[model samples]
Target: MYKRILLPTDGSELSHACVTAGLEFAQQLQAEVVAVYVAGNYQYPLYVDILPPNGPTEEEYQAAMQTLAESYLQPVREAAAAAGLACQQVIQFNDSTAKEIVHTAQEYACDLIFMGSHGRSGLGQFILGSVTTKVLSLCLIPVLVHRIKHH
Candidate 1:
């Protein structure tokens, strides 16, 4: 029923597995795929009084993030090509990964978001932060979280 699907990845093996499954699902639905990598924005060091002489400049940070994004999204691109599925790739920077994911979905008019969840619960989720939980709470579109049991 969905026309477009958004897949967000952090380059982990689990996320890549999710990407493969999500692409398969998109192929079944005859939908286009949007692969997005949201990197955290560069933050200046907190010590204003004692500034470090050697820190990444904003431009340097952007370049590094871009390189990292390409690394993370390369598999997605290759998978989409192999599946002969139409794919759009996006790179975004934001403090909140979940918000960026939802925004990307809305911006691309994606009908569904298919992403991996680490299955953190209760205290673990609260301490480590759960993007899946945040996305489920904030997103208006459908979210299908793929979880793989880890040994």
Candidate 2:
């Protein structure tokens, strides 16, 4: 009987599928939802001399990421509203998305995390490092991984 569910999305097709399912489940439970989107922070050097002349400044990069996050989160908001569920949306810019997700769950007092996995295996998953896997490793709360098997 999870009271609050955290749905973390990356705007991928698979992620959207998970969010949709999560929303439906939350609707059934009549639980509050927390939708979170994490954008990567700009980590490159900010010195003017070391950067390209036409390259965006750190502030510009941050603004762009924030805008992107808003776009990614908009659908979740609309879907939650349609489901008549209470949803809290959060946008975070951080290099480590898994950490941010765990933090958001803890900060919001979410009992469960519902998120998607690309279902990669072997060399690809090894090299790419699955954020979902990392979140599973790090987070204490229950995580329902919606593993999408692409054909």
Candidate 3:
């Protein structure tokens, strides 16, 4: 029933599974997929003066992050093409992953968001904060989280 599906991936093995599942679901529903990669703005450490002399410049770090984000989204684009489904790629530079994801879904008018869950423990989730959890709580749209099992 979904007309447009948003798939947010981080290029991790867990996210790869979600990409595969989300694409299959989109194919079945004849829905368009919007794949997004969110990159946080990198900030140099405060003690730059005392830091290593050969540290990468801010511009260089940003470029590398963008390149990595592109690599993460490339396979998703190819998979969509192979499935004969219309797809779009988005790159967002924001600090809050969940906020960016929700904003993208709203901006794109996507009905469903399919993403992977890292499946952190309760304590770990509390300490590190769970992006999927935050998205679920904040998003108005329906979210389908694929939890990958580690063997």
Please tell me which predicted candidate would have the highest TM-score against the true structure: 1
How far residue 125's Cα lies from its native spot in candidate 3, in Å, is 11
Q: For candidate 1, which ten residues in a row score worst on lDDT?
A: 120-129
**Per-candidate total of colliding backbone pairs:** 0, 0, 0
Record all residue pairs in model 1 with backbone atoms less than 3 Å apart, i.e. clashing. Answer: none
Residue-level lDDT tens digits of model 2 in 94-115: 8999999999999999999998
lDDT of 3 by residue, 17-78 (tens): 88999999999999999999999887777886775578778788888988999999999999
Colliding pairs, model 3? none
Better of 2 and 3 by lDDT: 3
lDDT at residue 37 of model 2 (Cα atoms): 94
Task: Output the lDDT of residue 32, model 3.
Answer: 100
lDDT of 1 by residue, 71-136 (tens): 999889888989988999999999999999999999999999998766444554324238888999
Clashes of 3: 0
lDDT of 3 at 59: 87
